[model samples]
Every structure is written in structure tokens, then in C-alpha cells.
Target chain A: MFFYLIDVFGTMAFAISGVLTAINKKMDPFGVFVIAFVTAVGGGTLRDVLIGRSPVGWMRDLNYVYVIIAGFFLAVIFRKKLDKLRTSLFFFDTIGLGVFTLIGLEKGLEINLHPVICVALGTMTACFGGVTRDILCNEIPVIFRKEIYATICILGGCVFFLLKALHVPDGLLYILTSGVIIATRLMAVVFKWSLPPLSRD
Target chain B: MFFYLIDVFGTMAFAISGVLTAINKKMDPFGVFVIAFVTAVGGGTLRDVLIGRSPVGWMRDLNYVYVIIAGFFLAVIFRKKLDKLRTSLFFFDTIGLGVFTLIGLEKGLEINLHPVICVALGTMTACFGGVTRDILCNEIPVIFRKEIYATICILGGCVFFLLKALHVPDGLLYILTSGVIIATRLMAVVFKWSLPPLSRD
Candidate 1:
């Protein structure tokens, strides 16, 4: 039940990001909704496929469609409001990264996947949607070059696994892992930090 | 032996499409090769997951890496010559699409997927690279527009299954399907034909 809230909120955040990218591109209404839907679910779709989940999540939950459509209009109607706080979008986006990574890690753990694969899965769930949106918007994925995006997800997953190894209580571990991610991401942005680019030859 | 040529040429074709998109974006050499590799192999990777193949292609074969690097430099060197052509890229692109659809169709058949899924895979394999590149370049995919893109792949897939149904010789079927796709795409370009938008309502 707790994780379900995280799932829905993560979806909403991803959907908003997609809608904003569409707006930036001046895509029409239909185009906006399509990108929104794909962005919200694309990462999870890839995750489901990797773990052999048949038919995928949106196929089972019609509400996912409605949520994305609603998010699109919400963005369109609230364009001025959003534009006013364009800076906070980064914070909201980081919160999404935290929630998504935890949800993904829990899912992988449920399936009894190896720890490494679970870490990869959590990272993908948190990052792939933005990557998809960036591609659709013809922008380089910010995660690949921005303030330690995938790195934070990896660290969150590692925290989760460490808590599990210590036999920490599930509820407490959940809070700890997600808190670490959100805090780490926010601090990184506040500090203007990122992994250095690969050295030139 | 013949399939090998088709595979290599298809990779080359997809790589060129990626390079073109990257060049258009003014990406660095590493960035260009990254886009080229993603554009060239993303569809196949998606297909592999759907069909339960592990590790993906590029993770399995370093040859794909070599191809994208080679294609990137080749594009950088030949951009001037390429710019001189009125439609040479389009011509080769059509050929690439045709051959790619055939290979995708053959792979789907090997895995015994449903005919419908097979054709979908064929269209995907032939069109998805450009779609990814376009998305990364922050534009609507050309194929999603009314272009003779996905349509050509569909037409070619139909030719493939039709030839098999008629007990056509294997080599002849390959030639026939590819020829149909190339001819249809070129003809559409010549005629400036397109599918109607879905939202006339």
C-alpha cells in the first residue's frame, strides 16, 4: 500500500516531465498525450519486459491512461504556474527519481532477482523515462551528463540492499533508502556537483 | 552467407541514419557514435527483450560497436559529398529499410512468433532506429508523420509472407520483397504521397 502511492506519484512526475517536453516542442494536444503516456510508462514497460511480466502494467490498469491524460491538461492549463517555478521542476524531478528507484528495487526484490540486476533495474526505472522524453524532445538525456542522476539511483539501491543485509525492518529501510536518494540528489544539485566527463585522449 | 551481407548492410544503413541525426545535432564524436549505436540497434534490443533473449545484441557482439564507430567517421568524412546529392541518402535509406525488414521478418519467423507480431517486428526493426534518433534530436519521428516509412515496411512484410505462402523460392522471395519495398518507398517519394492524418475529426 505504501509503495503503491510511490508508484502512482512517480508516474505522475514522469507524465509531467513528458508533457513539459512536448510543450517545449510545441506538439499538438494528441502529441502531448502520447508523449506523456509513453514517458510515464516507458521505463516500467522496459522493466516488465526484462522480468518477463506479460502484457505490462498499463494493459492491466486503465487508470494509468487517464492519469497521464489528466497530467497533460494539468500541465497545459497550469503552464503559467509551472513556468513561474521552472526551477522547482528539478526538485520535483529528483523526488520522482527517489520514489521510482525504491519502487523498482522493491519490485526486483519481490522477484528474487540478484542484487546487481536489482540495482540496474532500479536505476533504469528511475532514469529511462527521462531518457525517452529527452530523445523524443531531441535533447541529450540530462541523466547522462547532468548532476549525478543515475549515480544517485545506484546509491539508493545500494542503501536499500545494505539495509536488507543488516536485516533492518522493512518500513524503516524503505524510509532510509528513499531519504538517502532524495537528500543526496537535492544536495548534489544545490552544490552543483556531477561526475566528471571521461578524459579526452 | 547471403544473410550475413544483409545483416552487415542493415547495420551500416542504421548507423548512417544515426550519424545523420547526430551530425544534425552537432554532437561530439563520442556522442555521435552513441546515437548511431542506439539508432542502429535499439529495435533489435527491444525485440530481443520481448522474445526473451538475454544480454541484448551489442552487449553480446562487439562487432556492432565497431560498425557504429566506423559509420560515424565515414559520415563525418563524407558529409560534404553527401550534401551534394539531391536524393542519394533517400535512395540508400530505402534500400536499407527494405533489407532490414526482411531480416527482422526472418528472425521473427525463426522464433515462431505470430505472423502479426512478425510483421510488427519487421516494421519496428526497419523504422525504430530513425524514431530513436529523431526523438534524441528532439523532433517528431519522420515515420510517424505520413511519410512512406512504416508503410513501406508493412508492405514489404506482406510481400515476404505472401511469397512464402506461394511456395516461392527462398532467394527469389528475398529479392522480391526487398525490391517491392525499395520501389514502393522511392515511388512514394517521387509521387509525394502520404497517409491521411488520424485526427480529421
Candidate 2:
């Protein structure tokens, strides 16, 4: 039940991110909705597809679609106030990332996939929506270019498994894993941590 | 048997296009292979996922991977000669687009989706690999911005259903629909037909 709330919040945060990007790009309403929906669900969809899960997670549940629509309107109505809410938005986005990573990792474990592939799937789930959103908006994906985004998800996945090996209980595992992801992302931002770009030379 | 041959050829053509793009971007060999592989199978994989088909098309068959690898080496080894082969590549690419559109539409029909959604899926299958490649390379997707690429796929899908409703034979339907897509695309290129860009003003 707690995780469900986190999932809804994450979806809304990602949807808002997508809507802001579409608005900034001057996209039509249809394009805005499409981008917003994809941003909230694209990563999970990709993970489900890779793991051979059918109909994807979003298609099976209408709530995601509803949340995305709500998110779009919320962002549009509060566009003027968004700049001031940057910090709050970032916090929500980080929480979303953490929740999404746990969801993805758990899904992978359900299918008995390798730990490494599960970690990769978790990272993909937390990151690919933004990648899809940026692609649709015709910009370089911020995660791919500069950010400690996907890396945090990967690290959190590792932590989840490490704790599992140490016989952590289910509820505590979820909280600890999410806490690790959120804290790591926050520290990365505060420290201006980033991955090095591939050298062109 | 004939459709299988066409699918293989199309995969090769798309892979070549991906390799060329990666080379232009100065990506390393691994990156080039990654881009090429995604370009070859990304669209169909997406379609399969949306329809709840598990393991995707490429994962079930190893031939696609082998073909993509071959395409990568071919493009790399004959880099300088590629300019002279532009016309041939264009022909192959057009054929690939038609075959991929048919494949996607058929897959959708198998799952009993609406014809309109099937058409959209067909367009996604025909164009999205290129879109994914461009996004990974940090460029605007050519299909979304320019030319009549996806338009041709949609038109061909419409033609497919129209002919099917008129009781066209299966073999003849494939030929006629593919011919329509190929001819329309060729004509668009010859006449420089393109969608109007959104005005900045």
C-alpha cells in the first residue's frame, strides 16, 4: 500500500516532467499528452517488453493514464509557478526514481532473471522514460549527457540485492532500498556528481 | 518464405543505416553495433511489446542479430564506397519500410487490435528504429521532422485494409500493398514532397 502511493507519485512527477518539456517545445496538445504519457510509462513498458511480460504494466492498468492526464493539467495550470517549485519537483522526481527502481527490480526477481540483468532493467525503468521524452522533444536526453540519474538506480539495485542476501525482511528491504536511491540522488546533486563524457579526441 | 526473405533484407538495410549514422557520430565500435542492432529490431520489438507478445521478435530469432552484425561489418569495410551505393541503399530502405509496415500490421491484426491502432503500430514499426537511433545519437528524428516517411506507411496500411475488404487474395494483397508503399515513397523523394514544419512564429 505504501509502495502503491509512491508509484502514483512517481508517475505524476514523471508526467509533469514530460509535460513541461512538451510545453517548452511548443508541441500541440496531442503531442503534449503523448509525450507526457510516454515519459511516465515508457521505461516500465520497455522493461516489461525486455522481460517478456505481455501487454506491459500501463496497458493493464488505467490508473496510469488517469494520473498522466491529471499531471498534464496540473503542470499547465501551474506553469507560472513551476520555476519556484523546482526544488520540490526535484525531490518528487528523485522519489519517483527510487520507487520505480524498486518496482522494476522486484518484477525482474519475480521472473528469476540474473541479478545483473535485473539491475540493468531497474536502471532502464528509472531512466528510459526521460530518454523517450527527450527524443520526442528533439533534444539530447539529459540522463545520457550529464546526470547522476541512472547510475543511482543501478547502485540502488545492487544495494537491494546485497540486503536481500543479508536476509532483510520484505518491508524493510523496500524502505531501505528506496532510501538508498533517494539519498544517493540527493547527494549527487548536492555534490555536483556526474559521469565523465566520452572523449571525442 | 517470401516474407521471411523480405524481413531479412529489411533488417540488413536498417542496420546499415544505423551503422552509417553511428560512424558519422564518431561512436566507438561497440556503440556502432548497439545503434545498428537497435535500428534493425527496435520498431518490431516495440510493436510486439505493446501487443503483449513476450520475448519480442528478435529475441526469439537469432538471425536478426547475425544480420545486424553482418550489416555493421559491411558498412564499415565499404565505408568509402557507400556514397556510390546510395541509390541501391535507397531502394533497399524503401523495401524495408514496406515489409516492416506489413509485418507490424499483421502482428496487430493477429492480436485483434483496431485497424486504426494497427496502422499506427505499422507506422511505428517502419519508422521508430530510425527515431531511436537518432535519439541515441543526440539528433532530431528525421521522420518526425521531415519528409513523407511515416505518411507512406499509414497510407499503405489503409491500402492493405481497403484491398482486404474488397476480397483481395493474400498473396496479391501483399504485393500490391508493398508496391503502393514503395512507389509512394519513391515519388515523394523524387518530387521532394514533405510535411510542412511548424512555424516558429
Candidate 3:
């Protein structure tokens, strides 16, 4: 139940982020909804497809669609007040990332995929929405260049496995893994930690 | 057997286009291969996933990877001559669009999806590789803004359903549908046809 709440909220946060970006790009209503939907579910869709899960998570569940719609309208209506809520939005976004990573990792494990692939999936679920949104908006994906975002998800995935191997209880396991991801990301931002560019130029 | 050949050749052409774009962007070798592979198979992957087909087309077959690799090296070796082969490449690309559209439409039909959705899938399969490529290259997709590229695919898709409804023979249907797509694209280019921008400014 708790995980479900996290999933819904995280989806909304991601959708809002996508909606805001689309609006800023001056996209039409159709484009805005497309971006929002993709941002909220694109990562999980990719992961599920790769892992051979049919119909994907979102297609099977209608709540994601509802949340994305809500998030889009919230962004559109609250556009003027968004700048002032940047810090709070960041907090929600961070929590969403952590929650999403855990969800992805769990899904990967259920499918009996390799740990490495699971980690990759986790990171992808937490980051690929923004990547798709940026792509649709014709910009460089911020996660690919600007921050330690995906790296945090990878770390959280590692923590998840480590706890599982130690026979941690499910509830604690979820909290610890998500907490680690959130903390790692917060610290990365506070310290301005980032990956080096592939090209110096 | 014929469709298989078209698929392989189309994959190569798309990969070559991706390689050339990556080289133009001055990306490293790894990035080049990534872009090429995505450009070659990303659309099909998207279509398969959306339709609940898992392990996607490329993952189920190793030939795609091999073809992409071959196409990448070929492009690298022939970089200096590529500009001169622009007309030929354009022909291959147009043929690829038609072939891919047919494949996607057939897949959708096999799944018993709506005709309109089938046409959409066909268009996506024909155009999304370039969209993915352009996004990875950090640019607006040329298809979304420039020529009547996707428009041609949609027209071809409409023709396909029209012919199907008329009970066209299988071989002739395939040939005519692909021919229509190719001809429309070529004519659009020759006549400099394009869609109006959503934003006039």
C-alpha cells in the first residue's frame, strides 16, 4: 500500500516535470499530454519491454494515466506559482526518483534478470522520463550531462541487493534502499557532484 | 523471404545514416555505435513493445546487431564518399520507410488492433528511428519540422488499408503499397513539399 502511494506520487511528479517542460517549449495541448504521459511511464515501459513483460505496466493500469492527466493540469493551472515552489518540487522529484528506482529494481528481480541489468533498469526508470521529455523538447537530456542522477539510482540498486542477500525484511529493505537513493542524490546536489563529459571539448 | 531482405537492407541504411550523423557530431566510437543501433532498430522496438510483443524483434535476432556493426564500419570507411552518394542513400532511405511501415502495419493487424492505430504504428515504425537519432544527437528531429516525411508514411498507410479493403492480391499489395510510399516521399522531396510549422514564428 505504501509503495503504491509512492508510485502514484512519483508518477505525478514526473508528469508535472514533463508538462512544465512542454509548456515552456510552447507545445500544443496534444504535445503537452504526450510529453507528460511519456515522462511518467516511459522508463518503466522501456524496462518492461526489454524484460519481455507484455502490455507494460502503464497499459495494464489506468491510475498512471489519471495521475498524468492530473499532473498536467496542475502544472498548467499553477504555472505562475511554480517558480516559488522550486525547492518543494525538487524534494518531491527526489523522492520520486528513489521510489521509482526501488520499484524498477523489484520488478527486475521478479523477472529473474541479472543484478547488473536490474541496476540499469532501476536507473533507467528513475531517469529515462526526463530523457524522453528533453528529447521531445529538442534539448540535451539533463541527466546525461549535468548531474549524478542515474548514478544515485545505481547505488540504490546495489544497496537493495546487498540488503536482500543479508535477508533483510521487506519493509526495511524498501525504506533503506529508497532512503539511500534519496540521500545520495541530495548530497550530489549539495556537493555539486557530476560525471565527467565523454568529450572535453 | 523478400520482406526479410528489405528489413535487413533497411536496417543497414538506417544504421549508416546514424553513423554518418554521429560522425558529423564528432561523437566517440561508443556513441557512434549506440546511435547507429538505436536508429536501426529503435522504431521496431517501440512498435513491438507497444503491441505487447516482448524480447523485441532485435533481441530475438542477432542479425540486427551484426548488420548495424557492418553498416557503422562501412560508413566510417566511406565517410569521404558519402556526400557523393546522397542520391542513392535517399533512395534506400525512402524504400526503408515504406518497408518498415508495411511491417509495422502488418504486425498491428496481426494483433487485431484498430485500423487507425495500425496506421499510426506504421508511421511510428517508419519515422521514430530518426526521431531517436536526432534526440540522441541533441537536435530537433528533422522529420517533425522539415519535409513531409511522416506525412508520406501516413499516406502510404492509408493506401495500404484502402488496397486491403479492395481485396488486392498479396504480392501486388505489398509492391503497390511500398511503391506508393517511395514515390510519395520522392515526389515530396523533388517538389519541396513540407508541412506548415505549428508555430508560425
Candidate 4:
């Protein structure tokens, strides 16, 4: 129940991020809505496809679409305030990474997938949409170029199963795993950390 | 055998088209290869997922990857000549559209999908990468804005079935359908034609 609440908030964060990207790209409202919708659900859709889930999440739940469209308008109406709170937006995105990863892991476990596959799914759920958005915006994704983003999601998924193996209390494990991803990503960005680029000959 | 040949040609054309988009976007060579591969195959990937095909085509056939990469370099080497030949590019793209629609219809029929769904898939196969390219390039897709591109594919598919029901010869039907799409698209371009805009308001 608690996880579901946090999951929706994460969706909101993702929606805002996509809307901002479209606005920055100078897209009209219809274009902004399209980008935001894709950014918020693109990862989830890909996961569902790989797992052969019928109907997909947003298709099954109208609320997901509603929330994304609402997020778009909220961002547009409050663009000035959001612009002033760039740090807050970053925090929101980090929180989103945690929420998406945990839920994705849970979904994989529910489906009785292998641990490795579940971790990969978790990483994809948290990262693919941002990658899509960045590519569409004509930039290399931040996950690939800067900050320790996807790695944090991967590590969180690892910690999730490790805690489960030790049979840690469920609620505590969820909170701990999410906290780890958020902290790792936020710290890496704050401290200007990054993965090494591929060697240039 | 002829159908397979047409399929390969369509795939090659779409891959080259994708690589050119990546070049225009100024992506790295690896990025160019990736975009080209996905652009060529993205619609088929979606169709496969929808129809529950296992592992997907490229996963089943690694040659698709090698072909895409080769196409990428071929584009790079001939970029200047290609840049000067928009008309010729349009010809290849139209040929690709005709072949892709046939492939999509065949795949759907093999899977026993509804005829409506098959036509939709045919339209998708012919138009989706172009739509994806425009989205990635941050422009409204020409499919949604310009001439009756997807419409031609749909019409050709309909014509194939119409001729089949009338006991048309197999070879003649194939040629006639492909010719219809190619002629439709070329006529639209040469005649300054377009679909009615949803609204300019």
C-alpha cells in the first residue's frame, strides 16, 4: 500500500521531467503532452513487453494517463517556480529512480523470474525513459554520460534481494533499498562523480 | 524467395535511413549504429511483442545487426552523394514502404490475427520508423502531417486481399499491390498533395 503511494509520486516526478524536456525543446502543448506520456510510461511499457504482460500498465489503469497529463499542466503552470527549484527537481528525479526500481523488482518477483533478470528489469524500469527523453532531446543520456544513475538502481536491486535472502522485515527492506538508491544518486551528483568514459584512441 | 528478398531490401533501406538520421543528429559511430538498427527494426519489434513472438527477430538473427552496421558505414562513406539526392532517397523510402507493408501483412496473417489488425500492422510497419525518427529529431512526424504515406500502405494491403479474393494470380497480386503504394506516394509528392490537416486552428 505504501509502495503504491510512493510509486504514483514517482510517476509524477517522471512526468514533470518529461514535460520540462519538451518545453526546453520548444514543443507545443500537444507535443509536450506526448513526450511527457512517453517518458513516464516508456520504461514500464518495455518491461511489460519483455515479460509478455497483456494490456500493459497504463492501458489497464486509466489513472496513469491522467496523472501524466496532470503533471504536464502542473509543470507548465508552475514553470517559473520549478525553474527556481532546479535542486528540488533533481531530488524528485532521484526519488523517482528509487520508486520505479523497487516496484519493477517487485513485479519481477511476482512473476517468478530469475534474480538476474529481475535486477535487469529493475534497472531498465528506472532508466529507459530518461534515456528515451535524452535521445529525443538530442543529447546523450545522463545515465550514459554523467552521474552514477543506473549503477545506483542496479545496486539497490542487489541490496533488495540480499535483504530478502536474510529475510529482513519487508517494510524495512523496501525503505532501506529505496533510501540507498536515492542517496547514491544524489551524492554522486552532488560530489561530481562519474563513470570513466570509454578510451579514445 | 522474392518476398524474402523484398524484406531484406526494406530492412536495408530503413537501416540506411536510420543511420542518416543519426548522422544528421551528430551522434557517435556506435550511436549511429544503434539508432540505425533500432529505427530499422523498432516497428517490427513492437509488432513481435504484440503478437507474442519469442526473443524477437534480431535476437533470432544476428545478421540483422551486422547488416545495420554495414549500412551505417555505407551511409557515412556516401553521405555527400546521398545528401545531394533527396529524390532518390524518396524512391528508396517508398520502395521500403511497399515491401514493409507486405511483410507486416504476411506476419499478421501467419499469426491468425484479425484482418483489421493485419492492416493496422501493415500500416505500422511501413510508417512507424519514420514516425520514430521524427520524434527523435524533435519534429512532428511527417506521417501525421504530410501526404498520405501510411494510407498508401493500408490501401495496398486492402488491394492485395481484394485481388486474392477475386482469384488473382499470386505474382501479379504482389506486383500490383507494391506498385499501388509506390505510385500513390510518388504521385502525392510529385503533385504537391497532402492529407487534410486535423486543424490549423
Candidate 5:
């Protein structure tokens, strides 16, 4: 139940980020909503499809769609004041990154996918929504360019498996993994840490 | 046997297109290959996932991967002469679009999805490889902006259902649907037909 709420919060946060990107692109309302929907569900959808899970997470549960709708409305209504809420939004987004990574890792383990693939899935879940959002808005995905976003998720995945190898309790395993992800992300942003682009020459 | 050949041809064409696009973007060799791989299979992958097909088409078949590799090398070797082969390349691409659309439609029907959704799947399959390619290269998808590409696929899908309702035989149905898509796309390109953008308020 607690995890579900975090999933909802993460979906909402991703949707709002999509809304902001679409607005910046000067897209129509219909376009805005579509962007928000994809941004919220795209990552999980990709993960689900790759792992052979049918109908996907969002289709089976209309709550995700509703949450995206709610996020869209909230974003549009408070567009002017969003600047003031940046920190709060960032906080939620960081939490989302952690939770989503854990969810992906768990789903992968459930299907007995290789640990490397599971880590890739975890990073993908936490990052690909933003990647899709950027793509729709016609920009190179930030994560691919320089952000430490996906790296943090990858690190968290490693932590999850490490704890599991130690026979850590399931509950504690989840908490520690997410905690590592959330803290790293927060620190990365605070310290303005970024990956260096490969040299062109 | 013939349809499988067409599918392979289409995948190669899409991969070649991806190579061209990545080259234009001045991406590294690895980037070029990655773009080509995604452009070749991204649409079918997307379709497979949406409908709950597991393991995806490519993962189940090594031939697709091999074809993409062949296409990549062929494209790179012939890069300088590609301009002179524009017509040939476009012809292959058109054939791919038609064949891919039919494949998507058939897959959707196999799953007993509604006709409308099936048409959507078909259109998505026909155009989304190019869309994914453009997105990765940081450009707006040409189909979304103003191309008769997806529209032709949708029309072909409708024609497919219309024929089915008329009790068209399966073999003829496949040919006719793909024929309509291929012919209309050829005409659209020859006549420079394009969709007009919606007026900004």
C-alpha cells in the first residue's frame, strides 16, 4: 500500500514534468495531455514490454491515467507559481526515481531476469520517462547527454542486489535501495555533478 | 515466405535510413549502430509490447539482428553513393511501410483488439521507426509534423477492415492492404503531398 502511493506520486511528478516540457514547446492542450500521459507511463510500459508482461501496468490500472490527468490539471492551474514549487517538485521527483528503480528491479527479479538486465531495467524505469518527454519535445534526452539521473538508479540497483546477497530482509532491502538512490540523486543535483560528454575530436 | 522476405527487406531499409540520419548528426560509430538497431526494430517492439506479446519479435529471431548488421555495413560502405540511390532507397522504405503496417494490423487482429485500435497499431508500426530515429537525432518526427506517411497507413488499415467485412479472402486481403499503402505512399511522395499544420491561435 505504501509502495503504491509512492508509485502514484512518482507518476504524478513525471506527468507534471511532461506538462512543463509540452508547455515550453507551445503544444496544444491535446498534445500536452498526450505528452503527460506518455511521460508518466512510457518507462514502465517499455520495461513491461521488454520483460514480456502483457497489458502493461498502466492499462491494467486506470489509476495511472487518472493520476496523469490530475497532474496535468494541477500543472496547468499553477503554471505561474511552479517556479516557487521547484524544490518541492524536485524532492518528489527524487523520491520517484528511487521508488521506480526499486519497482523495476523487483519486477525483473520476479521474472528471474539476469542481474545485469535487472539493473538496466531499474535504471530505465527511473529514467526513460524523462527521455521520452525530451524526445517528444525534440531534444536530446538529458540523461543521455550529461545528467547523473540514470547512473544513480543503476547504483541503487547494485545496492539492492548486494543487500539481497547478504540475506537482508525484504522490507529493509527495499528501504535501503531506495534510500541510496534518493540520497545520491539529491546529492548529485545539489553538487551540480554531471557526466562529462565524450570528446568530439 | 514472401511476407517474411518483405519484412526483412523493410527492416534493412529502416536500418539504412537510421544510418543516414545518424551520419548527418555526426554521431560516433557506436551511436550510429545503436540508432540503426532501434530504427529497425523499435516499431515492431512497441507494437509487440502494447498487445502483450512476450519476448518481442526480434528477440525470438536472430535473423532480424543479422539483417540490421548487414544493412549497417552496406549503408556505411555506400554512404558516398547514397545520393544517387535515393529513389531505390525510398522505394524500399515505401515497401517496408506497407508491409510493416499489415504486420501490425494482423498482429492486432490476432489478439482480437478492436478495429480502430488495430488501425492505430498498424499506423504506429509503419511510421514509428522513423519517428524514433528522428527523436534520437533531436528532431521533430516528420510524420507528426506534416507527412502523408501515417495517414496513408491508417487509410490502408481502414481498407483492410473494409475488405474483411466484404469477406475478402486472407491472401487477397493482405496483398490489397499493403498494395493500397504502397501505392498511396508512392503517389504522395511523387506529388509532394503533405499535411498542413494547424493554425496557431
Candidate 6:
């Protein structure tokens, strides 16, 4: 039940992020709504499709759709005041990154995928929504260039598997993995750490 | 057997198209290959996932991967002479569009999806590979802005169902649908036909 609430909040955060981006692009309201919907559900949809899970998470559960709609309206209504809520928004987005990675990991493990593939799936689930959003908006994905976003998810997945190998309790394993991802993300931002772009010239 | 050959030919054309785009971007060979692979199979992968087909087409068949590799190497080797092959390239690309749209339509019909949704799927399959290639190269998708590409697919899908209603034989239906799409695309290109961008001002 608690995890479900986190999932909802994460979806809302992702939707608002997409709304902000679409509005920045000066897209029509329809475009903004489409962006919000994809940002909230695209990653999970990709993961489900990869694993042959049909109807996808959002299609089966209308709660995700409702949450995205609510988030879209909230962001549009308070676009001007959104700056004031930046800190809270960042926190929720971080929480979303961690929780989404865990969900992907769980789904992969349920299917008995290789640990390496599971990690890749987890990182993809946590990152690809933003990737798809950026692609649609005609920009290089932030994770591909500037941010340490997907890196954090990959590391979190490693932590998850490492803990499982140690026979850690499932509840504690979830907590530690998410804690690692969230804290590292927060610290990375505070420290202004970023990867240098690859150069072969 | 004939349909499979068309599918392979289409995959090769899409991959080569991706290679050309990536080369224009001055991307590394790995980047070029990634773009080619996605351009070749991304649409079918998305379609398969949407309808719950597992393992995806490429994953289930090694031939798709081999064809993409062959296409990639062929494009790279002939990069300098590619300009002279423009007519040939365009012909193959049009063939790919028609074949891919029919493949998508057939898959959707297999699952008994709504006609409207099936048309959407067909158009998506026909156009999204290039959309993805453009996105990865940090450009707007041509189909979304400047082309009459997907329109051909949608119209062809409508033609397909219309003919089916008249009890067209299955083989004839395939040929007619692809014929409409291919011929229309050729005419659109020859006549420089394009959709006007939406204007709301």
C-alpha cells in the first residue's frame, strides 16, 4: 500500500516535469498532455512490453492515467509558481527514480532474467520516460549527456543484487537500494558532479 | 516466402537509411550501428510489445540482426557512392514503408484490434523507425513536420479494410494495400506534395 502511494507520487512528479518541458517548447495543450502521459508511463510500458506483459501497467490500471491528468492540470495552473516548489519537485523526482528502478528490478527477477539484464532493465525503467520525452521534444536526452540520472539507477540495481546475494531480508533490501539511489542523486546534485563527455579526437 | 523476403528487404533499406543519417551527424561507428538497428526494428518491436508479442521479431529470429549488420556494412562501404544511388535508395525506402505498414496492419488484424487503432499501428510501423533515427540524431522527425509519409500508410490501411469488406482475396488484399501505399508515396515524392504545418495563430 505504501509503495503504491510512492508510485502514484512518482508518476505525478514525472508528469509535472513533462508538462514543464512541453510548455517550455510552446506546444499546444494537446501536446503538453501527450508529453505528460508519456513521461509518466513510457518507461514502465517499455519494460512491460519487453517482458511480454500485455495491456501494460498504465492500460490495466486507470489510476496512472488519472494521476497524470491531475498532475498536468496542477503544473499548468501553477506554472508561474513552480519555481517556488522546485525543491519539493526535485525530491519527488528523486524518489521516483529510486522506486521505479526497484519496480523494474522486481519485474525482471520475477521473470528470472540475468542479473546484468535486470540491472539494464531497471535503469531503463527509471530513465527512458525522460529519454522519450526529450526525443519527442527534439533535444538530446539529459541523461545521455549531462545528468548522472541513469547512472544512479544502474548503481542502485547493483546494490539490490548485492544485498540479495547476502540474503538480506526483502524489505530491508528495498530500503537500502532506494536509500542508496536517492542519497547519491541528492549528493550528486549538491556537489554539481557530472560526467565528462566522451572525446576521441 | 515472398512476404518474408519483402520484410528482409525493408529492414535492409531502413538500416541503410539510418546509417546515412548517423553519418551526416558525424557519429562514431557504434553510434551509427545503434541507429541502424533501431531504425530497422524499433517499429516492429514497439508493435509487438503493444499487442503482447513476446521476444519481439528480431530477438526471435537471428536473420533480422544479420540483415541489419549486412546493411550497416554495405552503407558504410558505399558511403562515397551513395549519392549516385539516391534513386535506388528512395525506391527501396518506399518499398519498406509499404511492406512495414502492411505487416503492422496484418498483426493488428490478427489480434482483432479496432480498425482505427490498427490504422494507427500501421502508420506508426511505417514511419517510426525514421522518427527514432531523427530523434537520436537530435533533429525533429521529418514525418511529423514535412512529409506525406504516414498519411500514405493510414490511407492504405483504410483501403485494405475497404477492400476486405468487398471480399477481396487475402493475397490480392496484400498486393492492393501495398500497391496503394507505394504508388501514392511515389506520386507524393515526384510531385513534392507535403502537408502544411498546423497554424493556430
Ranked candidates, highest lDDT first: 6, 2, 5, 3, 4, 1
Give i-RMS (Å) per prediction.
6.9, 4.9, 5.1, 6.8, 4.9, 5.4
- The candidates' DockQ values read 0.12, 0.16, 0.16, 0.08, 0.19, 0.17
The residue pairs that clash in candidate 3, if any, are none
Residues B92-138 of candidate 2 have per-residue lDDT tens digits of 99999999999888887887666766787898899889988988998
Q: Every model's Cα RMSD, please?
A: 7.6, 6.6, 6.6, 7.5, 6.6, 6.8
lDDT of each: 0.77, 0.87, 0.85, 0.79, 0.87, 0.88
Total backbone clashes of candidate 6, pairs 3 or more residues apart or in separate chains: 0
Candidate 6, residue B58: how far the Cα is off, in Å: 7.2
Stretches off by above 4 angstroms in model 4 are A1-44, A51-127, A132-201, B28-31, B85-87, B196-201
* Candidate whose lDDT is highest: 6
lDDT of 2 by residue, A49-127 (tens): 7777766677566688778889988887787788798899899999999999999999999999999998998999999
Q: TM-score of chain B, per candidate? A: 0.90, 0.98, 0.97, 0.91, 0.98, 0.98
Candidate 1 residue-wise lDDT at B23 = 67
Backbone steric clashes in candidate 2, count: 1
- Over the stretch B65-133, how does candidate 6's per-residue lDDT look in tens digits? 889989999998898888899899899999999999999999999999998999989988888889888
- Candidate 5 lDDT over residue span A38-93, tens digit each: 88888898898778787677756668877998999998888778879989888888
**Residue runs of model 5 more than 4 Å from their true location after superposition:** A1-52, A57-131, A139-201
How far is A129's C-alpha from truth in model 3 (Å)?
Answer: 5.3
Query: Once superposed on the true structure, which residue ranges of model 2 sit more than 4 Å away at CA?
Result: A1-37, A40-53, A57-131, A138-201
- Kindly list the per-residue Cα lDDT of model 1 for residues B1-201, writing each as its tens digit: 776666676687678777767666655554565578768887777777767775455545566667766776777678667666427666666777888788779879999998888999888888888887777766778888868689888988988898899999999999999999989988898899898888967
**Count of backbone clashes, every candidate in sequence:** 6, 1, 0, 0, 0, 0
The TM-score between candidate 3 and the true structure equals: 0.61
Candidate 2 chain B lowest-lDDT run of ten: B192-201
